[model samples]
Target: MKQSNFTTWFKSGSPWVWMNAGAVAIAVIMTLGLLILIAVRGLSHFWPADIVEAEYTIPGQPAITLLGEVTTREQVPTERLQGAGLPVDPEQNEFMDRELLKVGNRDLYGADFRWIVADWLSNERYPEDVIAIERREWGNFYGYLLSVSHDGEVVAEGEQAIDALQAAVERASGIYDEIHSLETGAIGKINTELERLRLRERGYELDNALTADRQAELEAERAVQNARYAELESELVDLYREFNRDSIMTRAMDGQEKRISLSAIVRVFQPNAMGITDKIGHYFAKLWEFVSDEPREANTEGGVFPAIFGTVLMVLLMSIIVTPFGVLAAVYLREYAKQGFVTRTIRIAVNNLAGVPSIVYGVFGLGFFIYFLGGNIDQLFFREALPSPTLGTGGMLWASLTLALLTVPVVIVATEEGLTRIPRSLREGSLALGATKAETLWKVILPMSSPAMMTGLILAVARAAGEVAPLMLVGVVKLAPTLPLNANYPYLHLDQKFMHLGFHIYDVGFQSPNVEAARPLVYATALLLVGVIASLNFAAVAIRNHLREKYKALEN
Candidate 1:
């Protein structure tokens, strides 16, 4: 039959193909753009930005010099500036350009950020002598190194002070590491052992078997731990004394001098003078520190190692729980059950469960997992730890279980689809070879469906990792005193609370006292969370691909 040009094009399907491809390309671009924005905002926070020294003048106010990094710049209406108590030139223009300076002498200025109209800034300079100091507390300090002192005596000055201060800082950092290890390692170990002994004594009391011999043994072990702790305490004291012996004197841009103890300093660098290579090295170092070190300064600064660890641990726990149960349910429904009304109703319920609000699951988790199941567990196994509510509290175990329940529907549906695809010939052939239905399902059907199982798992991991509301109610906390996994007895303590990267980002973005300082950290944390979830999914994808390849011949 003869056709018009439009009819011919429609029949070719080329237009639809092009439209689909364009839609996919746009989606890819948007996703990449978002990731690039996050990377730029978060990763740049680690780079040592050149510190600028500038003289700022405002009407009827004395000219003041400023030193620090230019953190933000934008244009604002002249009226807005006037409303904010800044003198604005009305005759000049409707809008005024402004810069926010991270003037890091927080101890002196009472704030880290300051805004000044760009027009009033003069004598802008990046001096090679200017140094930026990252302290253990009170944030950063930007100035010139005037001298390095030891025991209240000037040991080096001017150019020579840089080398001396670097050496002293290195030594102090080593001492700090030792002290940290002693506190969180040796002492932490001793404390865990002491706690175990206490719990053990309690257990014996509950059993009415508190024998004198057992008590004496525990006391003897505790005495040894005490002696070790005493020795470590003495060593820590010596380290602190050594660490505090050296300090640096720096001159602010306003010619004010301040002494900062070397022990309080985390790092010092000449950002204005740093070459590209130096900045790159410093950037990677800072990035590593952000991921490896424990958070400090109310979690607005430092690394989020605990959060990362907790997230991976909880997801792994959830995966372990959800996989078998999901597979079993799918097998029962798809393979064994008769096609009937009850089965159809059950399938509809499972599908509906997937659409339920996540916060509802959280409420269910708090009530059932924490209150009912946990209460019973505490009564049965941890009666001595009552009043304190050991297992009957929000914790990693309940959180993992709650997420498992939330994600099980996805896994069940995926597995059922896989089961239905395994040509009836294969199952019948297995049974024809003297195998029972259960045997054929176990060794044949399940192996062929492994790829689909992994697909479901990947989806579950992605969803569970990003879920914050449910975890907040079940287990996640602002800060966890100890990680779920540690070097203590029963290394994996599922009963303990844990930190999550999602919660960290939310808290730092909204709940932080220092909003300006925490803003960069929020972007960095969000990037890290995305990277973690991607890595997990990639691993699952690899396994899925391998399973698909292995089972391809069987299907054929």
Candidate 2:
């Protein structure tokens, strides 16, 4: 009876089907769980959490007052805490709850975070008068507003200080904008011209053509640019003076007063006093800034627009580069190559290359592309920039090419599979009707294969966006001084080094000096990277779907 029952169940095929369905369900649940965890830990960082003021007492130490935001909490058995050298009375408590606070006056407190026993906390309050200041240099400042001053004199005190300080910040912000504009715009133009003049003179010398007329022209241009530079410098000096004219005084929990320049401040907020509507507005504003601003403080704070731009730009360049080469190679192999031992061996090699490590491709690109090809180009055409190694360095161009090399096998294999799907009757019919074999393949075969090519591209993008190890050796950096793309001729600067979101996550998560401060940013950056890759894949998939629908008639 048991043998017959087993035979009947096996013959029904329901067991195998259930097993496959169960596996798929498990995968979906795991993926959603990961995304939810990432979202909660990352997106919640932008919200304006209420600050807590409390008194903490520990055994054998003086009772002290703590002022900051409660970032996290942990519970431990009293016996375990005692074993770890923390004095906890097991008779009084079975478990001790500890709260981690972000006490963000780093310059004053030596550290921005502290953990204390929550059971001992007393006089806990959320004071409405507390202020939080975000700065360009120091991580953050938390204190009570003391006074607002301008040029060594007090402008406002008491309840009016917040209003006065906000007005000063507005004026300082305008001046800061002027400074940035002058530096990046007019002065930047003059600097570029000066650089061009220098490069032109270098080229002439390298070519043995630095004649008297060329020398005179160079000097004349240099003098004009220098004069313009001097005028901009004078303007910059005045702006700096005005920018530093106002200051705000703040008192820490321990009653230590600090005078911070308005120029250094990014923003100031009274979180405890803000209503829910105000908090929501501020949260959205912060999210926008996170997506738009340049990173500061070792990439622990600020926006990652440069990284986002670089990742997208590099992937697009790789796509532009890989697609054509992959298609051509696949076409020759599938449609033109003689099918024999050599062809079989070449096919095996291509398939093997797909499994080669990405880092090996990065190394190959560095040696062959940068050192060999790029070095030769620099020597032949850019001799003037030889020592500076213009193209002969790991940069955006080489990075993209390396990724293209790494992902090209996938494209080739996919394209060949697509080409194979072209019905033999279509090719024969087109050839018989007056089209040559080339015309038949180009007009009838390639169009039907485009969807597969797009599928390959989607897979390539998904892999490339998350790659960090290869990029680190190729061109990615901890911090990029300037963006590769800017307001200049030939706006896409291929030879410039760039940042990647994947690398950003690695640096913030592992290389940061302040682990506690960088933890949230790492999660946020990781989530952003995942979103970016998914968006690219979705775009490619959409195109593939459209192409498939368009060419479905031909396939039939």
Candidate 3:
């Protein structure tokens, strides 16, 4: 009767236990799966290749090849280009000297061949001048055409008119400056007089007849000063009229330069949806150029290689910082320290710190590390760099230190758990064999617990890799032209600001004026970061399983 009762009770509790276990397993699996998806999507944005044509013609200049083949605008109908949805600026045609043509839509302006010609008068006066052009297309192109020339009479008249206008502006500016200086002096005198009047009013409290007649004379002088100041202000306004006088007068001097209409040029190269696809291909090609070349401007054909290098370097530095400190703390707490009130209190403090918001850490790091410790270090070791701030500033080293602090608890918790799982007999046996405590820990305890140590490191790394808030206050920048590591003197300067992937995503998404276009890139970068963390975790797990299997016989 007793055996039957025990069997019934065990069966009833089994279902509940199995249900809880299954739910936990499912949750873990789903989390890992999400991470893998994000990583895959992000890495794919850098891959893919495509092509499109860029076309433009000079004003009053027939399109002729170096080989002497004349291609009239009439021969190539604007409809061919329009069907392709090529970009055309009617305003550019109305105001500028030369017609402009680009490979694709203006919104996709960064991905193609962009051309512009300054108006005729400015063109000759600044002979080496080149109009701003952008090639914001995806793929490579086979052919490019540009015509540059101007009629002699139109060019000469435009140049003469611009010169006359510039002379007039210079003369007006001189007059404006003189009047402005005089007005400023007059205003200052008026203010002085007003202050005197105020002091005189205070004197009235002591005496009734204190300079009443003198005060009236000063007020009259102040009114005259005010009138002169207004006159000068009016003269300054008239100076602006001289600024655009050249352009306006030139238009009246010579009819607007004879130019091919950009709209007419677009009608020549138009393509269908196939053309759009082709242009997207060209866009990718242009993007590749940017990725492979050195940086030119903030927005230009250049690679993000420096940023990538800086991000990886910073993360690696942070890992180096966090790992040893975290692992040591965990080892001490789990193996050496007794479970007393103080130890328990310390553990609670660590857990609470882990839950504290990241931004708070940023502020703390900025104040304590950058201002205090760095300032002290500079004062002691770098006395020559006094007041210039050796350590009292943001840089790669401080950033790493800040992130290390943020990730310490994560590593400590992971390591402590791993240490707890080692059977107590292993330590007892080492001691029985006459091995010293230090030797036992170095030879057996650490080696045995290494897989768990690695697991903790992996978890810490995953968290640190994506952290942005603390980094912002420490040293991460939106754009870093050169990486922290370089072939210059002091190859690795810890004081320099570095770029990071998480910060890059924020910059491209929120800071860019072209947010709509940058959206895809943001998604791609996010995916890459997720993938990197997931891959590291997977490797750690693999190592853990291998260690478990290798130690199986010893456990027995």
Candidate 4:
């Protein structure tokens, strides 16, 4: 039997199909690999590794005892090590291995890490008594607990000191938490109330409504608030004294004894003595701290809750602003407008906007939104806070609006495509039933196309959540002292600058003075950003799927 052309083509299979499949496989593999790498590097940071005590010696220097966790190890060329001003043996192998030890005693040694050649280390020991102290100010401290004290007098010594120290820390931490709540909650509320009253009084003056009765009422309220504040202040003073009452003595690797106040320590644990279960518990505790606590030590230590909160809030605000605007524009273009040269031009422009570089949007947002629009707003409404700039500067509001504008094209294109996919028969059927165009669009057409609209929103959110450059130019800061949303009136402070995880990664990776310390945090933060974006995308996908299922019968 002779082979026909159709048989030959079918036997060979489709080149385009094979090529696309290969491309997709490669992309999937790359994405999975990247995510795995980020997860390993980031999540491993919380594990409490065993601490090593080693005696290190150099060719010309005396031996010194080093105590720390071995963070990393790498092979280096002997010539490179020599070039870096380290002593290396030329007679030995061409390559030399070195270990990076996190010998944290920043306040004592002035450095948190040190690199030593593998050949120079000896007598490595993992002592059960070796303690790692995570502090509030200085970095981690590796030492031995010598004694527990109160008011400059020793109360417990030896192993008993450890128990005493833990108990005291627990009590002091409770006191600290109470103090923080009083200061930032109750006291903060009073301050916010005072500020609101001041602003209201100013507004009254501006409106020429500061009547004598109103003035008396304001004064009486102020007096009551002042009296309450004085009572809180007295309580705060007592709490502070209680927090500072206990202290502990520690001996460093070099036998240098020092007294560390309990208030300075956040957590103390002997990692070398921990079993699998204890290590697991400690890991969870550390992870919780990373996600809930405020960053300390120039953002090299502590948690990233602020950055996470800001990124989510900004993305949500952007979504709210973009969805309506995008839907209206897409609806007009695809359904209401005449399909002519002008409409085509507008559609072309919208598509082109999506291709514009993100930084260009950032620059435009800075110039037009901040300088022009924001400046006008501040001048007209906030003259009392003039020279300080109020809304005349970059803020969360401008950042959200800027991102909405940047991502609107994506939403428009997706929604238009969705609207285009609806059958003409459906539109005709609704119109034939005596429905007007507007009523048909609102009641019938829009409901069927909701899945597509959600698809656009999903794309917009994916892009906006990962955006750092535009956010930086508009409002993102390295550290925000307060979150944008709080318990105060109006609740959301749109005019405040805020932190973002994407920008946090950038700052911690590039802008930080401590590269070694911040590198792991970069991976951790990048992983977090990916998870956040994925979570948001997944939610949108679920909604779209639900809408698709609901409207499938209508399409048929």
In terms of TM-score, which candidate is strongest? Answer: 2
Ranked by lDDT, the better of candidates 3 and 4 is 4
Worst 10 residues of 2 by lDDT: 481-490
Per-model TM-score versus the true fold: 0.96, 0.97, 0.56, 0.96
**1-556: candidate 1 lDDT, tens digit per residue:** 4568779989899999999999999999999999999999998999898998888899889999988888899998998988888877666889989998899888877888888899999999999989998898888998899999899999999889888888888888999999988888888998888877888889899999999999999899989988998998898889889989998889887899999999989999998778999999999999999999889878877899999999999999999999999999999999889989999999999999999998999999999999999999999988777778887899999999999999999999998998988999999899999999889988999999999999899989999999999998999998887789988778899999999999999999999988899999999999999999999999999999999999999999
Please give the CA lDDT of all the candidate structures: 0.91, 0.90, 0.58, 0.91
What digit string (tens of lDDT, one per residue) describes model 2 on residues 1-556? 9999999999999899999999999999999999989989999999999999988888788988889999999998889878878877899989889888999989998899987788889999999999999998878899999999889899999999998888888788789889988998888878888888899999999889999999999999999999999999999999999999899889998889999999999888999999999999999999999999889988999999989988999999999999999999999999999999998898899999989988888889878988998899899988887698888887999999999998888899999999999899999899999999889888889999999999888888888888887888778888887788888656778989999999999999999999999998888888999999999999999999999999999999
Which residue pairs in candidate 2 have backbone atoms (N, alpha carbon, C) closer than 3 angstroms, thus clashing? none
Residue 258, model 3, lDDT: 24
Give the winner by TM-score: 2 or 3. 2
Question: Considering only N, C-alpha and C atoms within 3 Å, which residue pairs clash in candidate 4?
Answer: none
lDDT assessment of candidate 1? 0.91
In candidate 2 the C-alpha lDDT for residue 135 amounts to: 90
CA deviation > 4 Å runs, candidate 3: 1-144, 147-302, 538-550
Cα misplacement distance, residue 127 of candidate 2 (Å): 0.4
Q: Regarding lDDT, does 2 or 4 come out ahead? A: 4
